[model samples]
Target: MTEMRYTTLGRTGLDVSRLCLGCMNFGSEQPWMMNDRDASVDLVHEALDAGINFLDTANVYSTGESEEIVGEAVASANRDDLVLATKVYGDMREAPNGGGLSRKHIIDQCEASLDRLGVDYVDLYQLHRWDENTPIEETLAALSYLVESGRVRYIGASTMSAYRLTKALYTSDVEDCSRFVCIQPEYSAVARHEEENMLHVAEGEGLGVIPWSPLAGGFLTGKYEREADPADGTRGAASESVRSYFTDENWAVLDAIRTVADEEDATPAQVALAWLLHQETVTAPIIGPKTSEQLDDDLGALDVSLTEEQVLRIAAPKQPRYPES
Candidate 1:
């Protein structure tokens, strides 16, 4: 390998590989666009062989298909050389008690995640999103219980509002529970929403920031035309979280990114990923691939470096899509 890099997850006592394999693609068959178990297996092995120690998936991913594949892969490796993480909090069932930070839900899902992954414990278990109805204490308490029970090695949170994340960290310290060791936010060259505040808060609190969709919902993948075809494929549909950013204005950023990609003789995907790696607070970028070729293109990011001038050239000026415009 190219002397693959590594970094420590702030205060989590977990040293994670700089490049984390995202298994969200392994989740659903209806989302027939993503990688299936067999295809994902090949890509995961490619990452493992490349010295990637961090693998991120979520219970809600493909309704837990992602976790199943990641779990199976980890077990097959049997080296304990990788740090595995997955999330909970999206509705996994039709019942009222199906999801959220409810003590019952968190605990129930953690065990189910473990079962699906075929592992006794998860390296890091995260709340996929915040639940306003439930007190942060209740959520942290349940997460603490898991760590204390040895079912989870560490805990993190994803998609929490800035205020809620800060509140959770403080609550964990005051209540003597497992705090969020990390925060998963949507960030990338085109998605700079987290930079507004979450990035600073995470860096200050000693919590690692793992950015999901660092590729900007396949916009950074070098495909899709802003004018020619507007309907995003299934991959873009999964990014309902960022549906608002898919606008004509954001296309300007894509155009500039493409220019830089051409200048470097690299794929836009490689340039996009390289953009995120330039940030120090970015512990790792969650990258999902549906094919070995796509996975290889993502890995090529490790080799491409952008100059300071180049980084500034495409830096999103304001909101990707103006709030008013």
Candidate 2:
């Protein structure tokens, strides 16, 4: 971790870790049970010790058990030094008013999230995903109100269309509301769809970009090679969200990435994340470390760098066959 680095979060003037630890796996140990309190605390402490100032979690992760774990971790960490973040706009429950970007649901979820996180405020409060039914103004105004109340320090949006993101920014400017200053997108060596125009919009607008699934949900870790059937219990094999990165084009990209990893004397995971950090517009690569060993390897990306040619060789952008159209 000698060469660990960070990047500024858009116009917020916050310096966040180049790699933000994503906590969606929290309390998801199996059999529909959340992680025990002690193990959760330990993971948070370990990440902080490794200089990971950024942590990303959401209300829907583990059906809110993830938020409880995140809350416990933050209390255990005990600091305003950490750049903690969490998201909303998910189906918090089965109730009609339980979800959406409307003021009622947004505020309700923010309070619930604050309670779950056990914090006075979160560094960055993000909309987990877009909601088209609600007007963008309603969402922005609600977030602005949160800022005014000091419950949320800043605001961000996740996995939104370029059109919506632009509209939100303009609406904020005109209405004097809290604007989204960052974007969270599913980006990886094999999934680079965000690069098409969403990322370009973020850069042009000076909005920070954090890429989720930086390893293509562990497909870039080299643990799921062509010859090796994915580990039986691994998330990728089990997850409906990430099965496609395993396709043929991604396999070619994987081979190219592995070659670079060997040349740099770095782990494939590390090389993959470094490639993400190399992108001019990417502020942070969201990494999910299910265990201490995995966390350590992911953090090692802090010291890895890819040569320009090495970067180009693996950046087969055309691979995300189902483009973000």
Candidate 3:
């Protein structure tokens, strides 16, 4: 096994593993989900044993089943040593106040998530996405209460525009609310849009960057071939999100990653992950592996060091831009 490395989450004193185990696949929400309780729990244990101490889940993932699985998986482990993170902002019920960053919903969902997680407090609580319906002030104030009440240690945000993020940070400072210590964006070799603004803002604000879908929804794994349909039972065949990556432009990027992987003697997935690890602004990349073998393969990226040239080569095909021409 590759020796794991740790780093502080952004400017905070909280230390987390360089890779966060994203628990999105541990439930029966979709056809592509793991859907097996024992297997999901075992995978979490395997990741923990492999030195991934940071676990990221959300209230909406599998309708909170992911949290239950993660909670049950870690019930025996020392909680202090693990960074348990989760997010809010997705509807849990069909009722009016079921979700969003509203103070009422945030407070309610935090409690619900804690209950499902079988914990008193989450190490890091985050907003799953920007809630345009709720004022940023209201959201930050509610999150501040979570911190003051000892139900949450730190707060973060995910998948928001750079302008909104900057405003939220400014609001937190002026309003004396708990500030965001990190930001989660959909960043990968195949999806460089965040680099045009989101990443720069995160680095400037000293926020930890934990990118979701770092493999471009499995496109960067080099499992799918050009001019061919995805195999049965594969993510590409089952998920429109995965099939969306089948563009000539993205294929060009994958070609570069394959070339680098051969040179480094690493798998295409490892090469893709290593590119994120090579970035100075990235604190961790969330790895969502459905199987133990996949988890082990992702961990190997820690040992695959790419030269500056290799990193640039893999990134060169798809530079950050808005609305590709």
Candidate 4:
């Protein structure tokens, strides 16, 4: 395996691996989940052995089972050596106060997440989404309290409009509350929408950009051809979320990716990840691998270097439209 590279997360002093291990598949919430505790633990160990010190999970993932699995995996490893991150803002229960970014929900979920992860303090605590129902001030104040109380070291946000993120940052500055240090946006070769707004915001603010679904739910892996149905056992066979990428525009993107992958003598997955790795604004791209073999292939992205022209070829299908300020 190639030597893992590390970078300081955004402008912070905290160092994290270039590829964050995503723990969303560690639990059995979905049919596509690995759903094997021993295998999930082994996968975590594999990542750790490969020099990945960053792990990203969510409290709502498998209703906290993913965190529990992660906690179990790290029990044998040194906690101080890893940068653990998880999210909030998903409905955990059916009743009221079940979820949202309100002060009560934020405080309550932080405790529950800490317990599930078996950690006193999480390295990064992110709001899974923007809760329009709650005031940004209330959410930031609660997150700031967590930081002051030492329950969370840093706060982040995910999957929100650029305006909302900017507002949150402004509110934090004015209220003297903990601000978001990073963003977890859905960015990949097939999904370039964030490049228009969120990426620009994160770059301008010096915030870390750790993108989720960097492979577009495996669409960029080149497993599905243009005129054929997805094979059984593949995500596309059962997941509408994965099939959603099967548009004409995305197929062109995949074609460009395929050409680049052939030139690099690498797998489509590695090339897809390499594209993200080459972006100046991206701090890390979360890799969700269900098995050790997949993880090994993903780790190979560090060694796959792309020329300037090759990068443009892969990105030519979708050009980002920057909004005039």
Candidate 5:
């Protein structure tokens, strides 16, 4: 295993691993997810052994089964040494009060997630998505209460627009509530939309920027061929979201990534991950691997260093195109 690297999470004092272990595939409640209890637990152990101390999960991931699996897997490890994070705002139950960032739901879900994870407090409690229905103040206040009550150490946001994120940060500052320490956005070699303003805001505000789906749902891994369809049981074949990424533009980006991988003698997935790791603004990129082998490949990213020219080459094709020819 390569030497695991650690960095400060945003401007906070907490030090998180450069690669966050995403437990999205830990439970089998979702048909598309393939990991069973034992396999998922084994992956967690492998990640820990490999020196990863940060784990990310969501309450709605496999209907909370992922948290249970993670809880059981990390039961033997010292909790204080690890950075455990989970999200709220996803509907765990179908009831109106079962979801959203409202104070009721945030408090209820944080307790429930704590119970499922077998931990008293999560290092980072995130809003899975922005809930427009609830006032920003209400959400910030509820999260602040979590921090004050000792159920959550820090707060974060995921998958929100620049405007909403700025507004939320402003509200937190004005209300004297807990400010978001980090932001999780869907960013990858093929998906560079967040580079426009979200990344800038995160840099300006000193918020850690952790990107999920850094492989573009497996497209950047060089698994999908140009003419052939994605293999069965893969994310691309199973998820419509993944299918949408199979466009000519993304394919070109993949080619660039492949070239860089070949030059570096690394896998395309590793090269893709390296692109994110090399960014000054990125604290970490969430890596969700169904098997330990995939985890190992992801960890290889820590060793794959891209030069400034190589990084630009990989990203050149992703530059936005306005009206033209």
Candidate 6:
């Protein structure tokens, strides 16, 4: 197997795989999840065998079963060779202090995640979402403690407004805390909203940009038809949330992507991921495949290069929108 390429995650000296394996679908607790423990373990092994050293998971995925599966999957591998990551700020329990970016929750969840993953430290401990109730300083302070304590090497934020991300970064600087080295956002041909300011902010701030849902929750795979209903077992058919992505404008975007995919003699999924890989600001786009075949197809994106005209054509009409000052 050809080894996947590696890249530096933002300004950090750590090198991570260009294709990060996301373990969201690794466990069966969630109704939409398709992988069981053994299958999840096999996928992780295959990913590592393919030279994908970066792995992303969250505490809330399958209520921590995902982490357990990941833990067993990578237990025998040399820990020092991988860049392990997991997120906090999700409700892991029903208690009042169950979630959010509060100091207590951040610290508590970090330990719990460490326990679940059976690892001493995570390379990147991300704030899954912005916590409005918690002060930025408080969250940063707690995360700083984790870094100082050697429980987390680096920190990242996901899915926050550009303004909010700016504030958090500024507060980390002023407070003399460990700043976020990366940002994970939803970015794809159909979800170009992050390009408006988030991508620019990441570029200017020297933050690594790792995008999730690079295929727009499987919508860019050209599986869902414009007139017909989503097929059974697909993400679009299983969840109303995924169905929301099948908008008229997104269908047009998919049409354009399909045209380009045909011209390039590649699958729409590969072309969609290649679009993200071609981005100068993107460090990597996380690929969460339900099966080994899917993982192989996603990795094929590395070979699908697009011309400048093709890139522009794929992104035409839907310009990034910026907020007014």
Candidate number of the best TM-score: 3
Model 4 agreement with the true structure over 1-325: per-residue lDDT tens digits: 5899999998899999999999999999888899899999999999999999999999999999999999999988898999999999999999999999999999999999899888899999999999989998888999999999999998899998899989999999999898899999999987888999799899999999999999998899898998999988888998998999998888999999889889889999999999999999999999999988899999999999999998888888886653422
Q: Write the residue-wise lDDT of candidate 3 on 1-325 in tens digits.
A: 6999999999999999999999999999888899899999999999989888999999999999999999999999999899999999999999999988899999999999999999999999999999989999999999999999999999999988889999999999999999999999999999889888788899899999999999988899999999899998888999998998898889998999999999989999999999999999999999999988899899999999999999888877776785433
Candidate 1 residues lying further than 4 Å off, grouped into runs, are 230-244, 319-325
Write candidate 6's Cα lDDT for 22-86 as tens digits.
Answer: 88888887666866788889989999999999999999998999999999998999999999999
Error of 1 at 39 (Å): 1.8
Ranking of models by TM-score:
3, 4, 5, 6, 2, 1
lDDT of 1 by residue, 3-110 (tens): 578888877668888778888777555553455567677778878887888889888877888777877677778647878898888899999989888999999998
Give model 5's TM-score versus the native structure: 0.97
Cα-based lDDT for every prediction: 0.80, 0.83, 0.93, 0.93, 0.90, 0.90
lDDT of 3 at 176: 90
- What lDDT does candidate 4 reach at residue 124? 99
Q: Give the Å shift of residue 10 in candidate 4.
A: 0.7
Better of 1 and 5 by TM-score: 5
Model 2 lDDT tens row, 1-325: 4445777998677998888988876776453232566776678778888888899988888777887887777776756778889999988778888888999999988898888988888889999888888998888989999999999999999887778788888999999998888999888887877777578789889999999889987888988877776666676667766576767888888899899999999999999999988888889998888678888898888788778989989975344433643
TM-score of each: 0.91, 0.94, 0.98, 0.98, 0.97, 0.97
Cα lDDT tens digits for candidate 5, 1-325: 5999999999999999999999898878756575589988989999999999999999999999999999999999999899999999988887779788899999999999999999999999999998989998999999999999999999999988788899999999889999999999988887887888578789999999889999887888888887898787787788898988878888888889899999999999999999999989999999988877899999999999899999998888777421111
Pairs with steric clashes in candidate 5 = none
Backbone-clash count (model 1): 1
As a whole number from 0 to 100, the lDDT of residue 35 in candidate 6 is 60
